[model samples]
Target: MEIISNEALSRCIRDAVRAELQEHFKTGGSTGNVSRERLLSKQELAAELGVSLVTLTEWMKKGLPFFRLHKRVYFRMSEVLETMQQKI
Candidate 1:
């Protein structure tokens, strides 16, 4: 069995993470420079899905995919539909 020193392991891990971050930044993050996915507001999503705000809130609690940015809630229609399909 071959064992590496703690410092070597740590350095290797750090280098790998740094390289990944550099690549991510180079490509303008996970979604890339221009995101084609349009983010919908809570009300917009609720209306689009033909559900009430209350039901949307319940779905959010039940693991419906959502995200909060700038103190506001948002959802991607594709993700919401995918999550709902999974729940069924």
Candidate 2:
């Protein structure tokens, strides 16, 4: 058995991640695919909905599904749209 070098391991991980992202984007680009999950920043979501950031915050308070990683917040586009449909 041979030990993998740190550089080789890092390169392998990077390549795997790149491939995964390329596949994700490829499948996610179709409009009729509802299960394609994509993350959006708060600003992006607000712009997509044609709403202000303040209004987005209000929506969060009203139970919009969101994820927080440290100081960053993300919204899942599919979930957001589903929530909107239910509310409507």
Candidate 3:
């Protein structure tokens, strides 16, 4: 058994994480691209914006763009950001 220094261990961990992230990106499993806009749940958006679900519902009533498939609602992150920017 060989002893590894703290710096060497840290570097090894960093390189492993970097390679995993790169592999994830290559497999289209990471959110590193803006072109691939993802639809988020109302709860997710509310948490992301630090707002309540009721407030999000109010925004929906006030013309916040959303998609409804059956009873579920989805919002595109990019569209939500753009709309919020326009509002401000």
Candidate 4:
């Protein structure tokens, strides 16, 4: 059997790990805690979903989707994912 030295083995492992991370960073969508970030303003919601401010307010007021706190609004990543799954 062929064997590589310790340093060569480490280098190859590091390169493979780096490549995997690069692919994750490039293509992994917001499928985790990132969606649970701080409260986003209505305008920010519209920007994220590519909707208009009025549409956002309508959706919020109707309780269609979104997290709300008094006059504030936010979103949890998991909630969004679940809602999308349901729609499918």
Off by over 4 Å in 2: 1-36
Query: What digit string (tens of lDDT, one per residue) describes model 1 on residues 16-46?
Result: 9999999989876765355568999999998
TM-score of each: 0.61, 0.59, 0.59, 0.40
What lDDT, from 0 to 1, does candidate 1 have?
0.91
Total clashing pairs for each candidate: 0, 0, 0, 0
Candidate 4: RMSD to truth: 10.1
lDDT scores for all predictions? 0.91, 0.91, 0.92, 0.69
Residue-pair clashes, model 4: 0
Give lDDT tens digits, candidate 3, residues 7-59: 99999999999999999889888555545677899999999999999999999
Best of the candidates, TM-score: 1
lDDT of 2: 0.91
Give candidate 4's whole-model lDDT. Answer: 0.69
Residue ranges of candidate 1 with Cα displaced over 4 Å: 1-35
